[model samples]
Target chain A: MAVASARSRGRLEHPRRLWVVGVIIVAAIGFLLAKGLGSSINYFETVNQAVALRSSLGTTTFRMEGVVVRGTVHQTSRGTDFSMRSHGVTVPVVNTSSPPQLFAPGRAVVVVGHFARGTDKFLSNEIMVKHSANYVAAHPNRVKPGANGSS
Target chain B: MIITRRQARRPLTSSSSRRPGSLVRTATGVVGLASVAATVWLGLWVTPPSTNLGQLVRLLYIHPPVAWVAYLAFGVTAAASLLYLWRRTRSVVWDRLAAASGEVGVLFCGLTLVSGSIWGKATWGVWWTWDARLTSTALLFVLYLGYLALRRVPSDPGTRAKRSAVAAILAFADVPISYLSVYWWKTLHQTGTVLNPQRQVHVHGLMAWTLLLGFCAFTLVYAWLVAHRYAVEALAERQQGEGLARALAERRAEGRAA
Candidate 1:
């Protein structure tokens, strides 16, 4: 009976336990390797915190966040600059880089850049806009009246 | 009557075998407590705050370790569930391990999410994003929750174990994908760093060692929790087996009386 029990356990341990252990070991090694090598990975932050610490922010090296203020966007030779309002503060953003498609009025956006000395302006390196939870319509204005030769 | 004579002789054998469990519990508990406390202390106090983020960097103490422990627990559940299914023996012992690991893993996973969000808010200025890694980790959490629910289904033990084993295996697959999603695609979630010895060593001396200790401490706590939960499972299984045996015996007596 002891031999029988041992045999059964041996059979059971083969595919399930051993296979999983193998996978975990391989994946862990891969993960460690990637981390061992220098990788640029940034964590997300919010607008309120960014605005509160604007004075101390390093020039062009930190990230900032706020809602895109209505009619604040202006196209420049390099890219665009806009006033983003968050937590009742207006953050002036200078985007020398292209913005994400979703950037517009009332939309929350995060900008990675550095605050310029004396000007308190943020020179952005990257821009990411947050989309709302509701599924966006495939056509932004499906009911455009007579705009596309429609009745 | 024949079986009773044999069983009476086995009582002494069973009594002598009870020490291993208590010994294991004590050892695991001590190690787990020490490691986790040490990690938390060193991580929060010893590590130099990020040049950029200052004390808000303390969020690293909980986020990475909690994430790692969640992975470890899911691996434990997958292995145990597979073994139970393959053995075809209704060992409630293994099931208990699966259930405990899944629940604790979920708890840690949730903590990782919360701590990560706080860290992000402090660093990036947004609470959440639909990044690849974040989405996958959330899915992984939901999958494990589903695995736990499968165990509670009213069915024969063998059938339930077999059914849950498949889900456990899928959860294991998700672990790697969740970890790698950032690297393989455009993701807002940062790739790993603390576990990489090379990178960790290069980090400012105080911060590196503190985070390392924190990882070790969380691992110990995880092991202790698993062992404690496993013991409770063993006791419950024993009670269940005894109840079934008594029911069977009573039914036999009723037939004889009839």
Candidate 2:
């Protein structure tokens, strides 16, 4: 009789355990969907988009993408100052953070910050280099310094 | 009704007929290793540095191939799970295959994250980011991990296999979403090079060939791993069944003596 009762209890608990696992899996999926899709959909805005929305986006932190205009990069005491251009619109950016090793003129970059108050210059705290999927062999003479001199 | 220990051990013994399967597995492993070595030699020495990415482009040979293998592994898991769920095709072999592939998928997914992180740090200037592609891929890694954990929960074989098969299929929904995340949203990670929707070949010459070799190498490795893992799963299940039978025999013997 005791063995029969224990087996019955075990059978009853089995479905309950599965129910708990089901609830947990559902909850985890919902959390991941909310976290992944909610805030990161618009990772960064283009220079033209940010410029068009400048009035409404005043001083709000956001990320903007544009190519660093040639001959516009300058190292200052605080950081680097450069102008980025996209869609024929240019925005001067004063980045207070050190740029990445790959940061260079004519390279596309995404800067994280906002427009400075009372000035047209964008204040950036971070810079990220962006490269396309296209891969071309570097010319013998055009190879950048310190790039595995074997090439 | 008495059973000897030798009878229990009989199920665990391998017959000589299985030699061909072992030979095939060994051949697959050897070819996989040889190709991986070739990829390393070519990727490091032969392929010229890209004008834009410089020497960092070498990471392309490692990251994308492993990422592709991860996708392939999960795809196999989903297909096997579907087979297990279908009444006509339902069998323990499918369940074992699904579990084996899912485990291997997690390993490759982890390698994907590590290799991608290293590449990101050098090229993107950050070790990590919460962009759409990165986040979705991370979610995928975690989802498979959850599937593996659910498979471990104690239950009767049939119940455990059924539930885990369902979980495997559901977890596979994340694989396509992760792959398409770059197109579905603006992301920091670059778009696909070879498998892009445009089908344009961004890679060329020796560089392209090296990348192709890397894909084939990693795929062979994944196949070899799944094959070995499935054999181990089969052996373990047989051992468990034999142990249960022995325990039941002992109980009956005690009842008869009493």
Candidate 3:
């Protein structure tokens, strides 16, 4: 009688084991989908988007992308001060962190920081350069020092 | 019967029968190595630096080519898996080819991520990011790795091949998603230079030629790797079959003596 009951229990456990495994796999996939999609939906906001949502954002740290306007870069005691423009909207940025080697005027960059309290200036601690796909060979005579307008 | 069987196996194991195929594989390996060297030399010394990116643009020659090879390897795996699944075209050859291509694809995919990370650090100022393009590519690498792991689960050949073929097909669904992620979402990673949807060419002159050469060279290396991997798989399968036969014969002989 014990042997019969044990055999029946073993058979019962087989399908249950499969069910448990299936549920675990489904749950893992669901979690990954949610996490991956949720984070990537808004990887970074453009300068226009950031400005439009500034009030609701309320000084929270986030990444913002824009092109560095030419002739607006200034090196200050605190950090580099510049104007980031996108879609005709320009936002003044004060980045405390040192910018990358490629960071210069007319280059696209993503700055990681937030808006200063009660001020229009964006306070950034990190600057990342974003280069385009265009690749043109440099002419020997045309390549000049500080041609990229780095501060 | 045992002596006769052993004699028959001896010829199959001999090198003479495989001489022609071995010669072709050797030649392919040699050419692939030569082209890779030429690409390195041209990329480093001959090709002029870009006006904007300067010397940093040299990484373009390797990164794009490695990424292209990864895509090609997965594409072949998908095609071979489909052949294995189709009733009219089903064969063990297709299954082996799919497995070989998948392993090679994983290797190239890893190279892609590493090379891309280095390039990103220099240009984007970040070693890694969770943007759509980067995330989807990382997912692809993990998915194929899972597929390879699934193949190792102990099972009979027919059942294993069928399940692995299904898994290969499922994993291949991510390739297109990864390729088009930049277009589908606003990504930190830049879009394709040569294969963009706009049909525009961002590279020019000697740089263009070197990039093309890199592609051809890496592709040849991929072919050589897959060929060697498939040969090894075939040899392993043959040895397994021989072992099974030997064990079965021994059991029958004991039964006869009893």
Candidate 4:
């Protein structure tokens, strides 16, 4: 009779134990979500998503990636303005300060800045010109290149 | 096992009469308090300001060390989780340790984010960015949060432990990746400044020594947090046992009355 009672009690406490465990997990997730949401969106996005979401982005700062259109790069006294092309769509980029020396035609570029409302222009604060596969192959010291690189 | 009514009502220590356990508890408490005190004092006031940022640079002393401690706690969680999974018999203890460490780790990680942001707002024109170090650290914070959440989803203890252990192990991968992502990627976040001995020698005088002392103090505080957390978990388990025993005894008495 004592053995049966002990077994029953153990069984009863089992659910409570699980409940406490669940609470701890929820607390952890809540903590992370709270922090993550406080920070801005800085995660990876393909050119397609950037284009599709272009309308709603407004003037908020963001990052976008595309290939530099061959004939669209024009350097002014202020800085350089160029058009980035991806998936047959083009967005004008105005860089107001120092552009990377590597910025040029047909290069993959990631511009960190903002998109103006009602226009296809992106005002960039920083520009990163993606290195090609040959740059990685020629330089053995470099690790994996961009997202498209393999071997 | 259901405790007898007599044992349930017994004085806490009378049932156990464990001297070594009490000694361990006292030692853990003392060490924990001392560590926290030392870390706070040395990290904040004792450290001198940087020439460039002046007083604002003091934020760096608190922020980086807290970040390091968080990583250390997560490492403990991963190792303990692995042990629990490997030897399933004594896993409850290990799982408790993992959970404790995860909580403290998350707390320190929060501190890191706060202090880092405060420093950034003072130094840089912006609050945050997609820089490799920042992004990876943020991901790490998220991954551990998810790991903790996995422990809670299931009602079965055995199933929860299994799943939590797996999550802990998998999330450990993010730590190294977070540390090294800056080296691999072209990131705005400056590469690690303190770890390399050669670079350490070159840093402007007071800043280097302050950081060194900060690391030491933070490590001790981390040890203290883990120890205290483990003890709290043990005490909670005992209280839980008592609650169950009391419930069983009341049920028995009601049956007799009926």
Candidate 5:
């Protein structure tokens, strides 16, 4: 009977107990990773925060995020200039590079730049448009009629 | 999905045609190969270039689908792992399914990161950034790597299943965070263009059509891949059982006689 029992095969020994321990450890690690995300958020400031800290932010390079004020975008030989606002505070940004196609009025953006405390302007090295995953028309009339082809 | 004790006794051999599900596996292989060829054609030649990125927009056809399937595969793995935890349904089948999905998810996850880098370099003039989305995506890839590694450690089948199931569940926590990283924080990465229904659609016209087809094609390929992988795992398990049986018979014969 002992030999017969030895021949029988089944699950590995101690799986159930080890699994419980693994679950605890994994959950703890996941929680730590989530908490770490707070400290590692991308932008250093919002538009309002940047303005409020303009004096201290003097010439210090940083990335700031804000919504582009509508109709404030302009094309210039230097590149592009726009106004971004948040929480009733607005900052003028001059980006010395062509903006992405998504960079337009009434969109959210992050600008990598330094504060020109004397001129009260943000001199941007790069401009990035931020939006959700939802697709919007890249432009009106881009799609022809009868495009409701969801299958 | 059922494997009887008798079936387990038989080892995997060249005579696989005698195996119960070998026919379906062969058919799946053919379909999967054909779909991949079609995808390559649509992605390279058929899709139009973007107004801005030009030829680089062709990445749109394959990138999104690869990313989507990676997410889908991980999601399935987590679900299967959870099922394996249930007392009534606790079995190695669910564990093997989870592992198969994990392997495929990692393949596509790597593809997604590479394709994304190529597209970014074309448009952003940069190959990489430590932005919120990019970092979270990299984290996701690492988590999957850890999960795969955990599966390979020497252990009894039951213990391995339990550990891997837990790894699958934990690794999946990153998937949602990676997807929502763009919306949750400001980053150099572009917002979600294809999935946001509440906002205006960025991709329009024939691009949208090709993207939809891309998803369909990749999803079908994933299903076929998983099916075949499961069959292979079953064959391997059968072989292991036969090897053990042979060792046991030899030991018994040694003690009993000349």
Candidate 6:
């Protein structure tokens, strides 16, 4: 009935109306998607960059990757405090929960959190340790509750 | 009575036992099975654990390709939609293709999300995050799901096609955002190591081969599924059309009797 409908609906008519209306609705949605991104987008920054622009960064959360500095970690039942360093710049990170198994010092880690206003301290809600591809158990005690180091 | 008459006249309306393309269907099933088998074998057995992620990196072979196909399916939908809207190319076939691709896209999109969540839980110590990549991907999944739902709403074929075309185009706006989320925002997700010029290829040797194989297998599987799903969509459309014709014919006979 495609042919039937086309004939009855007058296939000869111009389709300017449809084209115009579609463009308007689509454009409005696109605009909203773009505009709302500011609140949602969290940029990744290095420790050096985070500190250099701590005043400008304000309350916007971000992720920063660096190697944990040895002897700068303190663990507690309530939370853990550590410092991450890269290229001579070190950023102190305070996490609210037990760090992942590989979160020890001198290992590469990514901290997901934000810096307090006017403070150099980086407060992290989550910390992701860089795991190496070698199927070796770096620490038998620290491996995730159910995961093993072997295939 | 109308259904009986219709079914008798069109025995193949939805029957697959004696489909015209039985050989092709068999071939597709074989290929699909082979792809899945090979992907699992290589991804699990052949490839070494990732250099940094160890066993958790196994998800890479599956996650990336599943996401790739999800994106590919939606991209095909967007292209088909564009063709459907163009006056010179407007046709029910294009609409059918768009509908088929959108459905497949949603399926793969769901798989991608699940696989990604598992990978995240293994590596990131969490199952889900509101990071840009994940959040934008979730949005893409919902948008396409909405597109599928819209297709189900009662409407004439012409209106359905017109609305779906616009919806597909609108939904595709999220694909790029989801893809570029890592670069565009600060997120827990890692940037694309393969495609990004700034990053070097992280996997080498058998790992690279296995990853490549995973991508090829999934793509072939997607093609096979799309071929099957499109045929199903066409059959459903035919049944609807036949039902309408039957109703019209019944009304005409009543008018003559009156």
lDDT of 1 by residue, A1-151 (tens): 1111112223324556555654664565455434323222333345566656766654537555567887889999999889877677776888888675445566666677777777757788677654221111123345632122100
lDDT of 6 by residue, B1-258 (tens): 457776786867456546658667667678767877887998787675543565666787789889999999999999999999999999888998999989999999999999988887778777876678887887788788778766754556798899989999999999998888877776667777455546566566676667777788888788878887888888877766776687778889999999
DockQ of predicted model 4 = 0.06
Output the lDDT of residue B203, model 4. Answer: 39
Candidate 2 regions with alpha-carbon error over 4 angstroms = A1-31, A142-151, B1-18, B253-258
Candidate No. with top TM-score: 2
Residues B1-258, candidate 5, lDDT per residue (tens digit)?
899877875665447765657676667667766766776786688666554444656777788889989999999999999999888999888988998999889888988899888777665555776677776776777688668766755466777788889889988988888888777876667666676535666675777777777787788788888887777777767766776788789989998986
Q: TM-scores for all candidates?
A: 0.58, 0.87, 0.86, 0.59, 0.71, 0.77
Fnat: each model in turn: 0.01, 0.47, 0.41, 0.04, 0.19, 0.14
**Per-residue lDDT of candidate 1, residues B128-182 (tens digit):** 6555666667667766766765555445655666788777887788788787776
What ranking of all candidate models by lDDT puts the best one first?
A: 2, 3, 6, 5, 4, 1
Tens-digit lDDT string for candidate 2 (B1-258): 777999877766655325898788889899999999999999999899887788999999989999999999999999999999999999989999999999999999989999999999999899887788887887888788788777766667788788999988988988888899889888888889788889997786899999999999999999999999999888877666666666668899999999
- What is the alpha-carbon lDDT for the whole of candidate 3? 0.83
Off by over 4 Å in 4: A1-151, B1-48, B88-90, B196-202, B256-258
Chain A only: TM-score of every candidate? 0.60, 0.74, 0.71, 0.58, 0.62, 0.58
lDDT of 5 at B60: 74
Off by over 4 Å in 5: A1-49, A53-60, A65-109, A123-151, B1-28, B197-202, B246-258
Clashes of each: 18, 0, 0, 2, 11, 9
Point to the candidate with the largest lDDT: 2
Each candidate: chain B TM-score = 0.81, 0.91, 0.90, 0.79, 0.85, 0.88
Give the Å shift of residue A69 in candidate 1: 20
- In model 6, which regions exceed 4 Å deviation? A2-36, A55-65, A102-108, A112-120, A130-151, B1-22, B197-200, B256-258
The 10-residue segment of model 4 chain B with minimum total lDDT is B195-204
Full-model lDDT for every candidate: 0.65, 0.86, 0.83, 0.65, 0.73, 0.74
Query: By TM-score, how accurate is candidate 3?
Result: 0.86
True contacts kept of 1: 0.01
